[model samples]
Target: MTFVHAGHGATMLFMLLLLLGAGAVGAAVLSRRVIGLRILDYPTGRSAHARPVPKGGGLAILVVFVTGVPLAQMIWHHTPTLADKTLLAATAWLGLFSWRDDMHPMPALWKLGAQVLAALLVAWGSLGILPHDGTAWGMLLGRSLWLVVLCNVLNFMDGLDGLAAGCTLLACVVTAILCLHAGAGVDTWGTALVMAVAIAGFLPFNFPNARLFMGDVGSQCCGLVLGALGLHMANLPPLAHGWALMPLMLSGLLADVGVTLLRRTMLRRPLLQAHREHIYQMAHRGGMQPATITVLAWAATLCGAGAACALAGGVIGLPAAAGGVLALQLAWAVVVIRRVRHTPGLRW
Candidate 1:
């Protein structure tokens, strides 16, 4: 028992150090060239910051995360897990493709193809599109679809500085605590620790008026990592608690993106066009500062994720917990939308 505890502790420490080091290196590279490149300039948009800032700093976070996973596998003397390796390969490719798009805007079809391929890679390799233990193909398909949708939702939510990172950090921390209580293995804990550290190191540079934006590299990379982790947690044996908790953990983001897309579609608006229609953006437009909006969103995420962890631990029933959280998030969204609509100077 003591040996197990020590090993877990060491793994967590190692992951944190690896992520921090990698993030620092990525940030340094971006800080030097990010402002000067202006390769694929960020044009003014509705939700855009007052001034154009260097984007693609997320490549730094991606660099640190993708490289650190394999390095940690070797250091721990454990064979690289199949899920981890598959996710890394897919995410690396996705990051590269996104970075390419960021450098030179690609056609919509090409971007969609890349996202599909990346999603398929994870579905085939990690989640195994065919269900096991009598689970139906429909169930497997639903899960895979959820993975892809969630990945895109997170990517869409990356409009504001530090928003995605802050939300992801909160989700990871909650997941880590649940996994720890459930006696999850070192790999699970290590993955969470690394993500926490990476986001923590990157947040300072990203918050408020960011010096650098995460861009495509960071957003897609993070989506992949979180998606992969969500699958891993859900696949854990016996209880498979992650499935029950996922909706709550992701309630805020899922609600925001889903509602925005649905609302846009209903109004015959182009879904793919960049816009400042998210609830967070609306909150900002409604006399709230960016930082205040971010904090409110983060606080809501923490509550939802905490409720998810508690439900997963069997302290609370899943349905009631998930439904309650969802209701709260939906209410928040409706209020934000109403405020945005009524506010005289608000732009959506």
Candidate 2:
């Protein structure tokens, strides 16, 4: 599983293979450890799986990320900046806490506090990633809020097998393409490529029928990195409409998570408590196959991401692209809600 890019040459391909091999093999070994230790996510009323499955499989992603990234970045054109280093450090802190939570569930406040701290660390050292014109205070606070939102939204959407990873895989590829078009630093696009392939390594065991789950460990990491990278690109001078387009490109996730959160909030549902009220969860309970749900999510994500790239690249006007993508997502929401509305254990 090697992909040769135009200028980056064999380095990118080699690193991709390195990460893929590490992620796949490491995930397999972690699965055995989880099984032996009885670290399993058993089926609950809100769960997407039917049986107990290995839960800490995301340890493999963590290993591949920390080890492969340093070696891969050496091959990339740009060296790691202060912001990059800071982001990685923050991520390490996050993973430590998340891994603990994966083993023994933590309080919601603790998780939120840790996530906010990580987001703030990136904001503090993110001169390269933030806009140069803004006041430092505004840059730190505003971007921190945005990244925090992204982290939580992304985490909320990671409910089913291949759903979160597939959506993120498509979004990452699109983001990499856009960063390339805008001449973003290699640190940016390189991270995107590595993250995509790393997830590719983990997808096989988790998708279709779950043999292992990325659990809290992988979901939090995915959320944090995607949030950080997206905000970094949104600050690029040439990437007009990027801030708006980022959310829309992830409309499948934003719509489902956002709407569900809003719905739950209005109904005074225990926000901290987990439940199977997301449209995907409802649809799964309504008898939709996991594969079909995953495919639809990926399709909608790709469509939105493509439309966003067109808008960012000036291939299409903002009005046209936004209208098309929004309408498509709106229609998607309608269809999903209509199909799953009748399912038990799901309240709108």
Best by TM-score: 2
User: lDDT per residue, candidate 2, 1-348, as tens digits?
Assistant: 244355467756666566556655665565556556668788887787778887766666666666656666775655778877877887777877888998998889999999899888877767555455558678788878877777787678777888887787778778888898898876777677667766776787778877777777777777777877777677777887877667767877877888888889999888888878887777777788889988998998988888888888778988887788778877867876777677666545
Task: Tell how far residue 249 is off in model 2, in angstroms.
Answer: 2.3
- Could you tell me every candidate's TM-score relative to the true structure? 0.87, 0.88
- Find the number of clashing residue pairs for candidate 1: 2
What is the Cα-based lDDT of residue 279 in candidate 1? 81
The alpha-carbon lDDT assigned to residue 318 of candidate 1 equals: 74
Q: Least lDDT summed over 10 consecutive residues: which range in candidate 1?
A: 34-43
Q: For candidate 2, give the lDDT.
A: 0.76
Q: Which regions of candidate 2 are displaced past 4 Å? A: 1-37, 128-134, 341-347
lDDT of each: 0.73, 0.76
